[model samples]
Target: MHKITIMQMLEKYPELPPISQGTVSKIEKQFRKRGHVRQLKKNPPNKLSDDQKLDVTLMLEENPHTSSCQTTSALNISHSPFSAY
Candidate 1:
C-alpha cells in the first residue's frame, strides 16, 4: 500500500475544489487507514514539520515577553491554534 503524504495532495490536485486544511487532513487520514488512493494524493499543502515547531517553541522560550500573536507571526503560523474557534 502506498502511503501518501500531505505534501503530495496539494501538489497533484491543484484543480481540486478549494477545501480547508482540516478537511484535507481528515480525508488523508481515512485514505491512509484504508490504504487507498485519495483524490488529493498529489501535491499536498505545505505542512509544518516537527523540527519547525520545535524551532518556534524554542524561539518563544528564549523570549519571555514575546506576545503569542507576535510569536505566531515570527513562526509563520497563519492561524492561532489557541484562538477561540
Candidate 2:
C-alpha cells in the first residue's frame, strides 16, 4: 500500500530474509518495471560450446564404456562436465 512503511512490508512478509531498505526499494522498483523478480541467466565461464558438446557426445558414442575421468582426460576437458553425466 502507498501508506505502508518498509518495516510494515517486512513484517507483512515475515518469510523473506532480512534485507536493507535500499534493497527492498530496488526490488519494489524492479517488480513495478518488469512485473516479476528473477535473476538474469549466468552462463558458466567454462561451459562447453555446442561443437564441444557434440564432440563429447560423439566420443561417448564411440566408447560407451569409458569412465568419466578417462573420457575427460582423453578429450583434454575438465572433469566437471563429464562428471555431471
Candidate 3:
C-alpha cells in the first residue's frame, strides 16, 4: 500500500549486493528518463551497412592486395571505411 524509497528497497533486500547511493540514484534517474533500464544504443563511429561491406569484400576479392587509397577511390567510399579493413 506504500511506495518504497530506493534506500528502503536496498535495506529490505539483504541478498542484494551493496552499491553506492549515487550510482543507484543515477541508474534510477536514467530509468525514469528513458522508460527502460537498458543502456542506450551506441552509434558506431564508422559503421558500414551490410551492402557496403559486401561491396567492399567483393572489390577486395576481385583485386587482392589493393591499397586502401585505391580501394576507396575505386569504390567511391571515404578513407575511414576503407581504413577499417
Candidate 4:
C-alpha cells in the first residue's frame, strides 16, 4: 500500500483547477480525520439553476439599454413557475 501526500497528488494533476494551498490543506486534513470529504455540489439552494440564471444574465448583457421596468416585467414573466402555490 502507498500513502501519497496531497502536494504530490496535486503535482501529478496540475491540469486540475487551481486552489489555494491553505484551502487544499484544510480539506485534506478534514478528509484524514473524517475518512472522507463532503464537497459542495455545483448547485446550491435558494438560487436559480445555472442555465436559467445564464439566460437572464445574457439577455440583460446583450441589451444593456433595456429599461428597469422592462427587465422587471420580463423577469416576472420568465419566472412564473414560482408563482404557483
Model 3 Cα lDDT, one tens digit per residue, 19-84: 566777777888889998897789876867788788889988998898878877887778886677
By TM-score, the better pick of 3 and 4 is: 3
Worst 10 residues of 2 by lDDT: 1-10
Whole-model Cα lDDT per candidate? 0.64, 0.76, 0.75, 0.62
Off by over 4 Å in 2: 1-45
After best superposition, candidate 4 residue 68: deviation in angstroms? Answer: 28
How much lDDT does candidate 1 score?
Answer: 0.64
lDDT tens digits by residue: candidate 2, 1-85 = 4336566867888898656777777888999998998986888756676776887899889989988778778878888765654
lDDT of 1 at 21: 67
Best of the candidates, lDDT? 2
lDDT of 3 at 16: 82
1-74 in candidate 4: lDDT tens per residue?
Answer: 12345557668889986556676778778889988898646853344556656656777798989765576477
Model 3 misses residue 49 by how many Å? 1.2
Whole-model lDDT, model 2: 0.76
The 10-residue segment of model 3 with minimum total lDDT is 1-10
Arrange candidates by lDDT, highest first: which order? 2, 3, 1, 4
Stronger candidate by lDDT (1 vs 2)? 2
Candidates 2 and 4: which is better by TM-score? Answer: 2
Pairs in clash, predicted candidate 4:
none
Query: Cα miss at 85, model 3 (Å)?
Result: 3.6
